[model samples]
Target: MKLLIQNLREYLRADFHPRLYLATAAWLGLLITLNYTFDLEDVYIDSLRGSWKRPVLYILLYTTVYYVAMGLWTYYHHRPDLWRNRRFWLHTGVGWVAYGFYAGFYGYNRWSEQLLDGQIYLFAYYCLSNLHSLVTLVLPLYLYYRFFDNGAEHFYGLKPKRDGLTVYALLLLIMVPLIAFASFQPHFLDFYPTYKDTTANEFLGVPEWVTALVYELCYGWDFVPTELLFRGFMVIGLSRITAVDKNQSGVILPMVVAYASIHFGKPLGETLSSVLGGYLLGVLALSTQSIWGGLLIHLSIAWLMDGAAFVQQWAQQPAGLTP
Candidate 1:
């Protein structure tokens, strides 16, 4: 832990810029307030759900989020280089496209038709939605990495070593209580243990725990693409290009604010935490040149929260009944 702290201190000392950081905070804060005030994701994004137009809207949305974050950097630092750099545009522009594909993907809405008379339609809906990140984010991003970035070493910090494994585990352990506390918030249980409403177990003649396990795994899988994009590509990949000032890689804050924007659909508390979480993970990724720690921390916290939701729901069930 001390080693991790030292590394973070070094990153902060070397990379911190007051103007860029403050401007990013003020800009992102306002957007976050407006989004939560009006429920913009559901109100505006979902306004075109299932239509061909939605992905275009999402591309525009994420592009705006990313560009403004970078724009703030350019504005505060007075550097036209990031604007002139084609690599920045290539990296972020493609990201907006991939995010749009994932955010607007409704092809899974039809997945039930391929199953047994759509008997497990809700099951298909929940499970497929969780797994769609593979096609939407992974497939495109991987292609870009191989062809565009020329196959970065350790494949964007996907090393097999046990480096910092203990710290990642400690991070996960610390979040357990926080996850438990948040599970009791209004509308929390209704939204989590995402398979709670799925009748896959009944259709398959198995216990609900079976379906829960399946959905939880898929729920956890969704974060792979997330870590890969934000920590691996955004922080690690973009760092090599020297953003912000001529000698700085302070795009971590920029990535955090943009990352937080994507969380606008969730509760305000959750959205707010994303900024802090993204910064910590981004620092580690930048320091170690590995996203493995971020992936471990991210997936563990997510599954832990989902697990807490499951336990809460189970305790509420009748003595002789099952979900």
Candidate 2:
């Protein structure tokens, strides 16, 4: 127990930067204000159905608000050196452009499915469809890092490191039962198994399990872009441009705010919890310089929550019957 506590302490060091906090607060405040002012969260969710206007407004609002907040934070903190860093502005520009591609691709794919047509195989279509995020968010940064930057591995947080693997493992162990406990809530079950369509089953003329296999794989891969964008690019890549020391990364909380904002369309509880979860994951990525652990933890929670929801749905069925 003593050794275990030591290991946890070693990995879980507190990183509190005043400017980062202020910037995060401003970012969150802007999101909350917009959400309350116009019910933007619901509007944004509605946009996924067919309205391009709301999403475009959201992307514009988000980028403008966040960059303004960051600029003010840098000025107030008197970090003219950071402000003058051409790499800083360059990287920030790349990140926002990447975000535009992310939001655009997500909105496009979510609202329109024409690009996903013409696949002869069901699983192939599923796999290709999953590449939507990879193509938009991950590929642009990846290509830049690989070709322009001359390396895509470490900058993208793909380098292998075991620094905090134990802490992450322990956290995952504790999280599993807590996630199961949450799964028992009616609201939780209603929101999960997020792969609701199941149209693939009928389209492929295959059993539900077969379709599930494809859906889960695609769903799991969805996080790759997520991690790459937030943890890899925003946190790690931005650190190179903004870090003042080994321990302090100015970009962490800003990334957290943006990461949490992306969850605005989710359930309120999950969306709020994302702030904390995103922060912790961002810290881990910075400390260990790898996102694979976070990837594992995210997939574990997502798949487990999905499994729990499935189990609850099964149990709710009438006396030993299959749906």
The prediction achieving the highest lDDT against the true structure is 1
Give one digit per residue, the lDDT tens place, for model 1 in 161-191.
Answer: 5666677777778778888899987667766
How well does model 2 score by local distance difference test? Answer: 0.69
What TM-score against the true fold does each predicted structure earn? Answer: 0.92, 0.82
Clash totals for all candidate models: 0, 0
Worst 10-residue lDDT window, candidate 2: 111-120
Q: Model 2 TM-score? A: 0.82
Question: What is candidate 2's lDDT per residue for 43-145, written digit by digit as tens?
Answer: 6545564455544655675576557656654665556687688777777777777775566544444323554443324444545556577667777887778
